[model samples]
Target: MQSLIQQYFPNVLLLKQEFINSTIETLYMVFWTAIIAGILGTLLGVILVATGPEGILKNSVLYNILEKIINICRSIPFIIMLALIQPITRFLTGTTIGTTAALVPLVIGVIPFFARQIENALLEVDPGVIEAAESMGTSPLGIIFRVYLVEGLPSIIRVSSVTIINLIGLTAMAGAIGAGGLGNLAITRGYNRFQTDVTIVATLIILVLVFASQFISNTLIKKTSH
Candidate 1:
């Protein structure tokens, strides 16, 4: 059994330990980055919606400033943002070359992107629902929480799925800077070493992770939605 396995899956067997470690590292980066980006982006998104011209808060100055900031950050490519923020990353993580360092860029890169997504999701909430809440004398905070967030839950889940998948791709780019993960494993051990099998296996694992995320997200959306 061992001999047969080894014959067909030599590369997988050879890099089994690396494959496990890198997969775990990628999960670690994705989980934490998602949490941080999720919270900040949600806040920024809500603010963007609340401060729009027709928003409950209706502060154009604040809205424009935040919108510009989000736009500028989102405009920069992830790879360049990773390099451009090296100094900040080093200061925060004490090293700009590992999985921890990678989180800095990963979170920064996704925050604006997720914020825009969340804003769009919230915007999709029905205006009549918001008006009903307002007529009931609901405060702005109440309307935002009970109306926008609740009504948009399904859309938010869908957008979150998309954001997470994008973050996974960004993590691959992070591997270029020694952020050891499937991406690093695929590139450094597989491609650079000419180990085609290793690359294929790594790519397959990433695909599995992505599909799993999408499935879970879709399930949650279905459960939450009417």
Candidate 2:
């Protein structure tokens, strides 16, 4: 294996450029998607919770509709959703390949998942606080924006960390379809050419990235909450 890697070292260097480019692409895709989805998902989560049966703004009709929609979207596997949303991807980015084009599907794919996480996190908040806010005559939206957001910031950060890590993994899978990312590099240069070292290297990099993100986010959550 050492000799084989030595023989391909120069070629691997070229492919390594592609891997780096792919990693950057994946980062780009994940960051933008997280930004959009984070904002929108938080809103959706607040809405979902606030409009539930016991919510301050409870509305069975609306909550049921939103719930079903979220479920349906979340039910679709990421890979199939990639193909399914190709037209929208083209319309959004003018192409069905590359990192930018992948954003559409990634955002759509991640939003519901994040929203669910947000909902669960917020639900973990003490109801007494919400009740206290209600006694202060806070509007439904006010309760969510001020009370829930503030009180749940730590949980939000924690869940957001998880969501981000998952998004990174999805971004890699997106590479399988023409979306350039580390996953694409692994599949193309590593798997296609049977370059196991390339695959190992990409995997190690991703693991490091995930661990680093997790550590940083957890530290932030701890510091902020305390």
Candidate 3:
């Protein structure tokens, strides 16, 4: 068993601990960034939905401002955003390198993208449902939670899966800057060192993460949908 294992994926088997640590680092960045950005992005999205010109509570000023901001931030490429936001990252994390620092840009970078996703998901809710809720004198907050959130949950899960997959890819880019994740391992040791096996292993792990997230999202969507 060991000999066959050694025969294939030799670098990964040899650098087992590095691979393990790098994977953990990758998960850590993705986990925290997703959580933080998820909440903020959701809020941004909810506000956008609630305040848009066609929203139940229209506030063009707020909606337009938030829309422009989301566009500006989302327009910036993640790599350049990493460099562009370094000062802020340094201020937030007290340094601009490693897994912790990478998180700042990760969350900031994904927030706009996720916010747009959330807005789109919520917008998919039937306008008639919201109008009916308004007829019943259901408060704006009530409709948002009961109608928009409840009806849009399946879509939310789907978008979340997409966002997470994109985030995982971003983490790999983050690894390029000494964030020390699977990307770093793949780049510094695998690609840089011409070790194809290690690169394949890292790529495989990323694929697993994406597929697993998509599967879970699909299951939830099925269950959540009527």
Candidate 4:
């Protein structure tokens, strides 16, 4: 088995190299999308919380528009979004079949999802704390920036970690569309060729990625929550 891969697939090592490269690509997509989505979603969520009926900056106009946008975006499946945003991805990344191209859809896919999570996390913040901020003459902006954002940091990080891991999984699925990564390798090279070894390696790599992320995130959350 080893001799066959070494001789026939000189790139067997390259496959491992590809695994690492793809892992890095996946991380790049996940982190960049998460950061952008985290900020935008946090803002959207804060707006959702602060502008709901009894919210500090309640505005039926703004609230309705935000709610509808989030709902509509969330309704679209990630696979559909990949195809749906092909032109945009090409425009942004100059190609629609590699790691860079993968990011555009990944970001669009995650923002609404994370925004919803951020909304839920922020909503969990104590209303009394928000009220206190208001009572102290803190502007709505100040309340969101300081009170809500700060207090919600731990939960946001924890949720962001989950969002990122989910994005990694999504990246694998993107392989079906030619976004070369572990999934691409698994499907195109592994399954098609009957090389269960490739599939096993890819799955193990993904599991390790998830576990490592969980470990690091759990530690951070514990430290921050303290």
Q: Candidate 2's residue-wise lDDT over 142-164, tens digit each? A: 88888888889899999999999
lDDT of each: 0.92, 0.88, 0.93, 0.82
Candidate 1 TM-score to native: 0.96
Winner by lDDT between candidate 2 and candidate 1: 1
TM-score of each: 0.96, 0.93, 0.97, 0.89
* Candidate topping lDDT: 3
Candidate 1 — worst ten consecutive residues by lDDT sum? 5-14
Per-residue lDDT of model 1, residues 27-132, tens digit only:
9999999999999999999999989876888998999999999999999998889889999999998999889889999999999999999999999998898889
- The CA-based lDDT of model 2 is what? 0.88
Candidate 2 residue runs with Cα over 4 Å from true position: 1-11
The sequence of per-residue lDDT tens digits that candidate 4 reaches over residues 36-147 is 7777877778788888887778899998998899899999989999999999998988999887788788888888888888878787788899888888999888888898
Q: What is the TM-score ranking, best to worst?
A: 3, 1, 2, 4
For candidate 1, give the lDDT of residue 98: 83
Q: Please give the range of 10 consecutive residues that has the lowest summed lDDT in model 3.
A: 3-12
Task: Return the lDDT, model 1, position 85.
Answer: 94
Clashing residue pairs in candidate 2 are none
